[model samples]
Target chain A: MPFVNIRITNEGATTEQKQRLIKGVTDLLADVLGKNPKTTFVIIDEVDTDNWGIGGESVTEIRKK
Target chain B: MPFVNIRITNEGATTEQKQRLIKGVTDLLADVLGKNPKTTFVIIDEVDTDNWGIGGESVTEIRKK
Candidate 1:
């Protein structure tokens, strides 16, 4: 079984967009590694701007400056 | 900053259990890798039995047999 986890900044992705991501990732894994889509698990997590940081500064603070 | 994703079979984990997982992972990353807890992100994904498999058989099917 292949488990795929995707993390994105909380930018409010539409349901359709999330659906596309799930399907695309599953298809890619199946095509490349011959993994069964039925057994593939894809999960998406949206991180809050204040909670996600890069270069020691939160995304929320970076956006403010 | 560390981003940790945990995947487990969906067997109805309690809210407190998930909270402990998040806290424990964050602490471990900080202790082992010196990652900042403020910037650490821990997300848990519960996979459905029908979508998780091993050896070409789904967990759902395995459970049945």
Candidate 2:
């Protein structure tokens, strides 16, 4: 089965929201990847804002500005 | 950042080997993907033997006589 993993800064999400996101993504992968729901594996990492960036902008910098 | 994920039937590995595997792959991702070692996240799924197959051979069937 294809594996799916996601990493995002924990900047804008509450704990409940993060848990829901994990569940949703894991369910989606099980359906899309043709794997059993129990067999599907998803890992999400909540990173620090300073450690993540896009388009040359650190997450902390973008959030601040 | 590019994400990396791997899933394998844990038919052939000991517990220690699996731990080493996670570490090895995570370190490799840091070097190859240019992410911080602490920031890189990895997930491994050990699937049931009957639930996984390759080249039309179920893992358990192949392992069996």
Candidate 3:
């Protein structure tokens, strides 16, 4: 089974947005790819802004610098 | 852009297997769901058995225990 995990650093998203995103992702995978949603696990890990990085820089500290 | 990253704990696989796996995954996503492989990033991180865990136990140590 193919697992789709989305890890986001943004903490400002509302509950509805997260739910919609999950639903959209699941539907895209299941409906289009014909994947079994029951067996296909989707984990959304909401991480703090301080824990993520891009282009070899910390998102939090780099933004300040 | 949707990113499909596959992280595996097995380090014993050959390069061919890894290539095949990536191709299969990419084909499944692109052909079935019509995703653009150029924009849809697929990263396969091959992790050592020592770094992975399952059910709250490290894979390497748990196997010995």
Could you report the DockQ of all the candidates, in the order they appear? 0.09, 0.12, 0.08
Structural similarity to truth (TM-score) of each candidate: 0.54, 0.46, 0.48
Best by DockQ: 2
Tens digit of lDDT per residue, candidate 1, span A1-65? 69776788987776556666777887888889999887787666678999999999999999999
Residue ranges of candidate 1 with Cα displaced over 4 Å:
B1-65
Arranged by DockQ with the best first, the candidates are 2, 1, 3
RMSD of each: 8.6, 11.4, 8.2
| Cα deviation of A26, candidate 1, in Å | 0.1
lDDT of 3 at B48: 74
Select the stronger candidate by TM-score from 1 and 3: 1
TM-score of chain B of each: 0.91, 0.71, 0.76
- TM-score, model 1 to reference: 0.54
User: Ten residues in a row with the worst lDDT in model 3 chain B?
Assistant: B27-36
Highest TM-score scorer:
1
Cα lDDT listed for each candidate:
0.78, 0.59, 0.58
Candidate 3 error regions (>4 Å): B1-65
Clashes of each: 0, 0, 0
